[model samples]
Target chain A: MKRRNLLATAAMGLLLASGGAFAQGMDKVKACFVYVGPIGDGGWTFQHHQGALAVQEAYGDKVEIQWQENVPEGADAERVLTQMALGGCNIIFTTSFGYMDATNAIAAKFPDVKFEHATGYKREHPNVSTYNARFYEGRAVQGHIAGKMTKTNKIGYIASFPIPEVIMGINSYYLHAKKANPNVELSIVWAFTWFDPAKEADAAKALIDQGVDVIASHTDSTAPLAEAAKTNGAVIGFGQASDMAIPEYMPTPRVSSIIDNWAPYYVKRVGELMDGTYAQVDSWAGIKEGEVEIGMITDAVPEEVKAEAEAMRDAIAAGTYHPFTGPINKQDGSPWLAEGATAPDGDLLGMNFYVEGIVGDIPQ
Target chain B: MDFGGINPVILIATLMASAVPILLAALGETVVERAGVLNLGVEGMMVIGALGGFIVAVQTGSPVLGFIGGALAGAVLSLIFAALTQVFLANQVATGLALTLFGLGVSSLGGQGYNGIKPPPTEQLLPDALADLPVVGPIFFGHDWVVYFSIAMTAVLWWVLKATRVGLIIRAVGESHEAAHALGYKVNRIRLMCIAFGGAMAGMGGAYVSLARVPQWVDGITAGAGWIALAIVVFASWRPWRVLIGAYLFGGITVLQLNLQVAGSVIPVEYLSMAPYLITILVLVIMSAGRKANGAPAALGQNFHASR
Candidate 1:
């Protein structure tokens, strides 16, 4: 069966070569996105949808955008990707880490169709390209702010899952917070959910009750901010995937936010497809590449603290500083990086341990 | 008392608030099952209620009227199930499942513009003086109006079920619809009222979540809360007061688990995540294994025909 499939792929490649449709660029490209959560979630999936919209606006008539929201990340993803591929999708973007395997499986089946998987490292097929933002860079900025802004000397993280993406963010947040405040204590609350507002609210309340004045959540909802809003001014938090610096929680609960700017990446990839320059690339861009942005810092932060945080942000964007620089130790107190050395991309992508000071298991 | 930073007062208060949605929803399902009808679409009614309540709250800027609108919307949707099962004599289980799917889809469709919109805060029923009375103040008095309303509903439902003739008649119809019909009571009519009542309760529960708890509109906002409510009804053995206990136990465990995780306890937080459902399952085993408890209404989920 494998031999037959390989022969079929070869024949299709030969036919495509003879037809020479994509030899230069094509006039029109249909870009598709599959989201893991509802676009109304106001966070991760919403930001991705914003990126999809930017692709449409970038090329008015040259690109046709199609998307399916709340597509679960297992067998269902494979079926959706297969449907999109069969429906003549020029390029399909699977916008969740859980969809990695499904994306590659479908990409293998449809060798002619290009596949892009976000925040995932697996690219078993050449048509598949992996892209992720160095969110820890933004985490460094937020953590620095969290450490500086806390009145209780304790901060909390309402983490969604134990994935590397979330782990690295926590590590960077704690490390930066500790740097800003020598006596800072970090509390971690694992909610183990992506989008349940009630549970997320409970997580936030738990932290607030613990006297953790600064809260950070990896879950995709405004519940954390809403909970912080109830605290009046005792608790402050940062927006997760999107800029949640809305009026209700603004300048107080939401001191700042880390906005995931996928517009540049989306438009660039789709443009490459149209311009016949698209190829497999493992792109991991951050603040420097404008894929990760520090949202507008509100006036709630003290002047000097805000200036320091901005300087750190500038350093990250300028590629002169790394959030996971050396002088770091694993949770067990073994040195992971030497002084003056930065974390390698491979280590960051596969991060599974807490940096020394964070007090809790990763729920392996 | 603070046990490893797990404050008893805050934990109880948070549990009461979090449990209100499930408590109200389970109470509604208990009433429906007692009336000899099994409406498995509580989740659907609740989500529709969430959307309806959120829309009304956003439009009128009144959390009270928004709750009423949510209840009304749930009643209107359940009337479709009532008409299908009670009137048309369709399969109750299938119709109920279909209602859930329909509710989720329609609410998401209706919820296009309501995203990220926070409803007006539901105010506390008691004064700040009463709420600031230390441990008792926060635990018993600091909660908003819906928490009190949920407790009142449990009492009212219990009175209407255990003592009153209205409760007796409803149970008579539930236990033996044919006998009730022979004695000149309209079983379907009684069930129609009960089903609508159930939907309103479920809808109000959904509204409480949107307007009071989460206070934002998201598609499928009720999540699987309705199913949990259904499980509680079975676990409660169709008793109203037991449903209240079951709901609080579930809600308390959820709150407790979060607190425990924050305290960095020795208990595996991963296991704690599933503890609530695990207890529900355990209670279900005990209830079914030991037959001394009150069981489901015999006429539950049955179609009634006057001629037959």
Candidate 2:
């Protein structure tokens, strides 16, 4: 029995060595995904799952997709990635910022396998690639509409942790809102959580009680929108990761949304892998690349305001407008960008401070 | 710097609403521990309750029936732990942990078709006159029925434990199952009942979170609230009234920190976010230090076998 097992292992190893041509002349590619939250989270993970489904839909039987949901972003992620690599998965996508270290560590061990980490920065191994969407671009559009629609001139932001990614979104949203309406005052409530609905709702309620008429969030849930709906047109919110404009609360609470369109990128990368042309590239695509999309700006906004927001979206897509173009100053009144100077990608990627108008310090 | 818009009444009202879920779960845990069973599956039971309550609330269009469904779901999940530890003589702690894992998986599975769905609205229990009372009106009278029910359950549990025979028998069994057994009481039977009660309360707590607080269903909707309830039980020192206080204290800190952030307070937001957990630990340490005896039941976590 031991000899027979060893013989079977040898045969499998031979099959793996002969790249496209096997004894049966069939080649198949297995792609696996690791999600930080369950696919039913309705915000972040749910959208990523849709992208994985798109990959299957694009390739038919030539590609196989497997995903393990709710994989925590620590040691457990490493174990899951390792198991997927051992199970003959040719490529794996670790989809969260927290999986940065785990993806790199696992990628080192599985040199022949390709690893993709989303919303992360590190690429310690040659086989590891990182990709992220410019969610701030969508934030810019939401801010434009928020500034115009808020009757109280007070826009509340429900933030999730003080990471650079979240901070960047906050600053972009605040800046655009300030531009659209200089009278807008931004109020931020840092919930320090990615997806706790009750806490998110309480944050929204607190902001609303304090006279915030418009709300924006960098968290992963529809709770803020639901909380806004409770006010009966007195409060409005923008959806964060997905279009959360459910039929019941549509056109009012969720006037617009920032959607993470990962399908095209996922499909393109998988195509590259199938053709043996995949490379370790740092891809940060945004509006122009069709990675980050702005959901419909419903009739809740006035026609002129909607037109302005649409123009900004078109300008962003046409590469004529940059969200960070400014004579902007730091929160402490230090010079950040000169007049009409566009802030570089490096500054935006490592953004940790709020722009001048935003109150309070970014928690270290 | 800008604290002008912060209203004390609204702040306190939000605090009460936030505290109800934890208070209910802690009160249930208080009873279960008083009867000598240490069930670590509160989180599991809570998630199942959240999903179960959400499903029923959506189908029936009644928040009341939704909460009942949540309690029932929680109780049923707890029965698995009771059978494992009480009937089959399994390790209580291990079985409880397994129950939590099972609950999370099953609840997520049950929640598949229910994502992005909103539950029926829960109305304020008090009339406008009472609910609109200056300062105290919003704080004390503007919550849904579950908020009042949680406090009432604490009071009722306190009365029963202090003045009732059933409470004495349950405490006796918790203190020493062998002695309770020699006294001709059914140890496992009483424990089974306590477990079911704990499960029901936890389910209601979870249901309150999904059906009332957020009014929507998402995966892992309970989101570590059950564990907070467990910590609150310990922080309460196994007393019902203290559990109420502990739950509110945590809730108040949570609401206050968010208020501080919105007011542009100078304190770091991370420190503000960590304040509740730190305060809970400090309170627990001080309470444990001041008390001469540990508040835990004598036979807590010890599986009782009839022959042994």
Instruction: Please report the candidate that would top lDDT against the real structure.
Output: 1
Residue pairs with backbone overlap in model 1:
none
Candidate 1 lDDT, tens digit per residue, B208-288?
888888878877678689999999998888888888888888999898989998888888878989898888667655756
Worst 10 residues of 2 chain B by lDDT: B1-10
Total clashes in model 1, counting residue pairs 3 or more apart in sequence or in different chains = 0
List residue ranges in candidate 2 displaced over 4 A: A1-26, B1-5
Clashing residue pairs in candidate 2, if any? Answer: none
* Predicted candidate 1 versus true structure: per-residue lDDT over A1-364, tens digit per residue: 6999999987786566324335668778889999988788888888999999999999999899999987887999999999888777889999988899999999998887899999999999988999999899999999999999988899999998788999999999999999999899998988878888888888999888888899999988888888888877889999989998677777888999999999999999999988899999999999998999988899889999999999999998887998989999999999999998999999999999999988878897
Q: Which stretches of candidate 1 lie over 4 Å from their true place?
A: A1-25, B292-294
Best model per TM-score: 2
